[model samples]
Target: MMERKLVFGVAVGVAVGACVVAAVVVGRRVKSRSKWKRVVRVLEEFEVAGDTPVRRLRQVVDAMAVEMHAGLASEGGSKLKMLLTYVDNLPNGSEKGTFYALDLGGTNFRVLRVHLGGQRSLSLEHDVERQPIPEHLMTGTSEDLFDFIASSLKDFVEKADDPDQLVARRKELGFTFSFPVKHASASSGVLIKWTKGFSIEDMVGQDAAESLQQAIDRIGLDMRVSVLINDTLGTLAVGHYQDPDTVAAVIIGTGTNACYLERTDAIIKCQGLLTTSGSMVINMEWGNFWTSHLPRTTYDIDLDVDSPNPNEQGFEKMISGMYLGDIVRRVILRISQESDVLGPASTRLLMPFILRTPSMAAMHEDSSPDLTEVARTLEDILEITDTPLKVRKLVVKICDIVTRRAARLAAAGIVGILKKIGRDGSNGIAGGRSRTDIKLRRTVAIEGSLYTSYTMFREYLHEALVEILGEETAPHVILKATEDGSGIGAALLAASYSS
Candidate 1:
C-alpha cells in the first residue's frame, strides 16, 4: 500500500512539471510574435513615408510660387526697382573698341572679348576661353583661389595683344560675378554668401570687384572691373540698354532667380538714401520662396532630407537643374529596391550624383532612332551597362515626370511675375499716372544654361504661361533668351553710375 501511494505522488509531480514546461514554451512564442508585429508596423510606416516624393515636390513648388509673388510685388511697390541703366559711356557712334567680359558662373568661368563698331554690329574678334575650376581651388583658401584666377586672367590678357593696332582709350571690362552680393554702387559689391558649389574659406566678406581687381593687379594687368554685377542684374541692364522695353530678367539654370528694375521711392527699406533717378536694381533671391500650389513627390522629400540646407529654398530644391537629375535617380533607385517592376537587382551606379543636369538635358532631348538617345543617356549617366529595354522605359518615364513637373511649375512662376507686372490686369499703380502708360506690354529677358540647352523647356514654359494668362496676352508677353546679357549689362551699369 505504501509503495503504491509513493508512485501516485511521483506521477502527480511529473504531471505538474510537464504543465510548467508547456506554459513557458507557449509564452515565449507569444512574446516573439508580438515583437515581430511591432517591427512590421514600423516597416509599413517607412514604406509609406518613402512613397510620397510627388506630394513633397508639390508642396515645395507651391511654397516657391508664393515667395516669387511676394518678391516680385515686394513691399514699396509691385515694382522690383526696375530701372533702365544708361550706357552713356559706351563708344559713341562710328567708333570701334574691344571689350572684355569675364563670366564667373557655377561649374565654369568664361573669358570673352568682343569687337564692336559704331554701326551697331559686334563680332567675336577672339574666341572665349573656358576653364573648369580645379578640384582643390574650389574648396581652398580665398587668396589661393583668387591667385589662380588672377593667373588665368593674366594669361588671357597676354593673349590680347593685337597684330594691327586699333586706336582706343584704356580698355574697360565687365565682370559677371554670379553670386549674392550687396551692391553699394555699380563699381563694387560685397559678397554676402557663396553658392554654386563653391565654398572658398576667405571670400565671404570681400568686395567682389576689389578681389578681381587685386587679382588683376597682382598679375600687373592694367584693367578695371568697371561693371561689377550679378548675372541677373547684367541681364536687365543689357536687355534695357539693347531695348528699353526689356524690363525684367530671370535666370533658370542649375539654380533659379529673378531681378528687375524698381523705383527708389518704393523701397521703404532704404528711406534715408537718395537715388538721382529714383530707382535701383533689385535681386530677388527668389529661390527661397515657399507656398502652396506646387507638386512634390517622395523623392523630393528624400532629397530635402539629404540636402545640405534642409527646409530652405524649398522651391529651388524641387525644380533646379542641380536637383532634378538627382530626384530621378532617387525615384528609380527606390522603385528598383522595393518593387518587382524592375525584375531584379538595382543598377550599380558607382556614383549617386553622376546623373547631372546636362545628362538630364540630353535624355530629355533624345529622339534618335529606336529611342537609343534615351537609352544611351541613361547608360552613360548611371554607368548602367547593358540595361534592358524595360528598365530603359521606366527611366524614361521617371525623366518625363520630373521634366514635366519642373516645366509646369516654372511656367507658374513666370505667370506670377507677369501678373505682378500687370500685363494681365489694369490695376495700375498710382492709377496709371507718373510713368508712361506701359499698357501691359512686358518682356522677360531670360538667361542661363538650362534655358539655353533644354530642348522643349521653352515651349513647355510658354504653354504654361498661355494657360495662366490666356492665349490673347500670351503673345503680348515676350520671353527671349538674352545671350551674354550679363557681361555687357555690367558695363552698362557702370555707365549709368558714372553718368
Candidate 2:
C-alpha cells in the first residue's frame, strides 16, 4: 500500500512539471509574436511624422523662417567663428580662362577642368574622377585625411594627357571646401566644424587652403588655390553665371543649404565691414533653422533621438535625402512591434539600426504593376522574405505620405525665401517700384540628388509651391534643377577672385 502511494505522488509531480514547461513555451511564443507584430505595424505606418498634430506644423515652419533669416544675415555666428560666408560678387558673361575645380563633399570627391569662353560660345570641357571614402578615415586625424586627398589630387595632375591645353601656366584652381568654414574673403577660408559623419580633430580651426595647397605642392603639383568657396556659394555663382536671373541657389543632397544675393547694407552686424558695392552673397545654412510650423511627424522625432545632433536641423532632418529614408525605417520598425498583421516569428526587424536611408530609397523606387517592387526592396535591403501583398501596399502608402509632406515643407521654405528677398513680384530684380512686390517672381537654382534623381519629387515640389504661393504668382517663380553647379561655380568664384 505504501509503495502504491509513493508511485502516485511521483506521477503527480511529473504531471505538474510538464504543465509548467508547456505554459512557458506558449508564453514565449505569444511574446515573440507580439514584438514582431509591433515591428510590422511601424513599418507599414512609417507615416508617423507626416501625421504629426497639425497644430504643431504651423509653429515649426514659422520658427524655421525666422531662424533662416538669422543664420543668413550672420555667417559664422556660431561660437566657432564660422561666420556667414560673404560672396558679394556674381559672375558676368566675360569670365574667360582655363580653370579647374575640385569638389570635396561628403562620401566622394571630384575634380574637373573647364575652358570658359566669353559670351561667344562658352566652350567647356571636363574630366572627373571619383573615390569612395574609407570609413576609418572619417574618424582619423585631419592631416592623414587631407594628405590622402592631396595625394589623389597629385595623381590627377600627373596623369593629365595635355596639361598646357587644359590648364594655364599659373594653374590657379577653385577649391569647393564643402564643409563649414570661416571665410575672410572669396579666396580664403578657415575650416569650421566638420559635418556629415566626419570627425577629424585637427582639421577644425585650420586654414583649408593652406592644408590643401601644401598637399598639392608636396605631390609636385604646381597649383595655386585661388578660391575657397562653400558648396552653396559655388552653386549660386555657377547658376548665376549660366543665367544672370538666377537669384538663389540651393543644395539638398546629403545636406541642405541655400545661398542668395543680398545687399550688404541688409547685414546689420557687419556695420563697418560692408563693401563699397553694398551687395554680398549670403549663405543661409538654412538646415540649422528650427521651427514649429514645418511638418514634424513621429518618425522625425524618433530619427532626431537617434541622430548625432537632436533638436537641431529640425527641418533638414525631415527633408534631406540622407535622413528621409532613415525616418521611414523607424516608422516601419514601430509598426512591426505593435501590430499582429505581419505574423509571428519574424524577428529580423527587431534588430537595432537594421534599416538604412539607401534601403528606404530602394523601397521608394518601387513602382510595379502590383507594387511588388516595394516588398522586393524591403526584402533586398533587410533579407526578409515572403512579405504579404497587403503589407506591401501599406508600405507604399506610408512612403507616399512622408515624401509628399517633405515636398510640401520644402516648397513653403522656398516661398519664405522669395518673400524675404523682395522677388515675390512681377517687377523681378529690377529696382523700380517693386520693393513691396509681395508676389512670387524669380528663378531659383536647385542642386541635389533627391531633387534631381527622384522620380516625381521635382513635380511634387512644384505643385506644393503652387499651392502655397497661389496660381497666378507661381508662374513667376521658376525653380530650375541645375546639375554640377557646385563644381563649375567654385571655378567661377576662383575666376572672380582672380579678376
Candidate 3:
C-alpha cells in the first residue's frame, strides 16, 4: 500500500510539470503573435495595392510631363535637370573605319576599339582597366586627375599593337564622361558638377573636353576626343544604330536616368542652338524628380532623410539598385525589433548597406520548398537564426512588396516620358493632334544589371506597364535590352563625328 501511494505521488508530479511546460509554450506563442501583428501594421502603411492604381499612375505621368516642361524652360527651374545632350545625330549604321571610346563613369574605366564594317556590321575589341583614384586626386587640381587619365590612356594605346597601330594614325576617341555638363557643342562641354562620389573643386566651370585634350597633348598621345557624350546618350546612339525606331534609352543599374530625342524647337532655353538633324537628345536627370503622387511610406522618408544628400534623388532612393537592398534591411530590422520570431535584433542590421541588392535578389528569387535561401540570407546578413517557416515566408512577402512598388513606379515614369513624346495615347503629344497620324510602333532601348540580371524586377516592370497602358497600347511599345551598348555607342559616335 505504501509503495502504491509513492507511485501516485510521482505521477502527480509528472503531470504538474507537463502542465507548466504547456502553459509557458502557450504564453510565448501569444507574445510572438502580438509582435507579429505590430509588424503587419507597419507593413500595411507601405502597401502599394491601393495607392498605385491606373488612375493614380496617370496622375504621376501627368506630373512628370509637367515637370519636364518646367525643367526645359530654364536652368534649376524644376527637379528634373533636363540637360541638353547636344547629340543632334544618332548612329545610322553607316559609320565606317576604326574608332576608339574612353568611358570614365566610375572608378574603373573602359577603352574600346570598334571596326565598323558599314551596313550594320562591326567587330569590337575592348579592354577594361581599373585604377583607383587616389584620395587626394579626387579633390585635388583638375589637371592632376586628367593627367592621370591621359597617362593611362597612353599606356592602353601603346599596347594596342606591335608598335604599328600605335603610330598608324591619330586615333579619334569618343569620350563618355558620365557627369553633369553644359554642352557647348558635340565635342565640348563645361563640367556642371561632379557626382558619384567625386569632389573635384576646380573642375567645375571648366571645359571638360578641352581639359582632356590638353591632358592627351601633355602625354604626347595622338588621340583626339572627337565627341563628348554622356552614357545615356551613348546607349541611345547604339540603339539607334541597331534600330532607327529607337527614340529613348534608360539606364537602371546602380542608379537610374534616361534620355530621349526631343524636337529642337521645344528647347526654349537654348533658342540659338542649331543641329543639322533637327532634333536633340535631352538627358532627363530623372533621379531628382519628385512629386506628391509618389506613394511614400515612413521607411522611404527615413531613408531620404538619412542619406548623404538629404531630400535629393528622392525618386532614385525608391527605385535604383543601390538602395533597394538597404530598404529591405530597414524593413527586416523593424520586424526583428518588434518580434522575437527572428530571435534578437542583429547588430549587422544596424549597419548601412550590409545587405546588397544581389543578395536581396537571391532571397526574393529563392524557390526552395523550405525557403532555405531566405534562411541562409537571414543568418548570413543579419545573424538571425531559428526562424520559423511562416516568418521566412513573411520576409519574402516584404521583398515582393518593395520590389513591386519600385518596378511599378519606374513604369509610371517611363509612361510619363511616352506621354511627353506623344506615344502613350492615340492623340499626339500636342494634346489635340489626330491619333491616326501617329505610328503605332515605338522602341525604348534599356541597359543595366537590374533590368538584365534581375528577372523578377524586369517582370514586375513589364507587368506594371501592361496594367498602366492596357492590352491595346502596351503591345505597341517595346523595351529592348541593349547590352554594353554604351561603349560601342561611344565608338560609333567617334566614327560619325570624326574630322
Q: What overall lDDT goes with each candidate model?
A: 0.63, 0.69, 0.84
Pick by TM-score: 2 or 3, better one:
3
Ranked candidates (TM-score, high to low): 3, 2, 1
Summarize candidate 1's per-residue lDDT along 1-499 as a digit string, tens digits.
9999999999999999999999999897887566445434433443454332434433433444344344434453322232222222322223345666788867778776665553433322434778888978878887777777778866876676674423334556788888777776666778888887889868898888888888887877766777776787777765665556665688888888776655555444555546665556667665665554445556677788888888777768766888888877776666555543334554654345768877776776666645687777755555455656655665666676677667667766665554444443333322333233334567778887767778676666676667655566667778878767655655444444432
Q: What is candidate 2's lDDT per residue for 127-195, written digit by digit as tens?
A: 777777788888998667777887887777667787565454667688997787878776778887988
Q: Give the TM-score of candidate 2.
A: 0.79
| Candidate of highest TM-score | 3
Q: Can you give the TM-score per candidate against the true fold?
A: 0.73, 0.79, 0.92
Residue-by-residue lDDT tens digits, candidate 3, 235-343: 8888888888888998888899999998888888888778898899999989999999888877888888889999999889988999999988988888777766678
Best by lDDT: 3
Q: Candidates 1 and 2: which is better by lDDT?
A: 2
lDDT of 1 at 39: 38
TM-score, candidate 3, is 0.92
lDDT of candidate 3 at residue 235, scale 0 to 100: 82
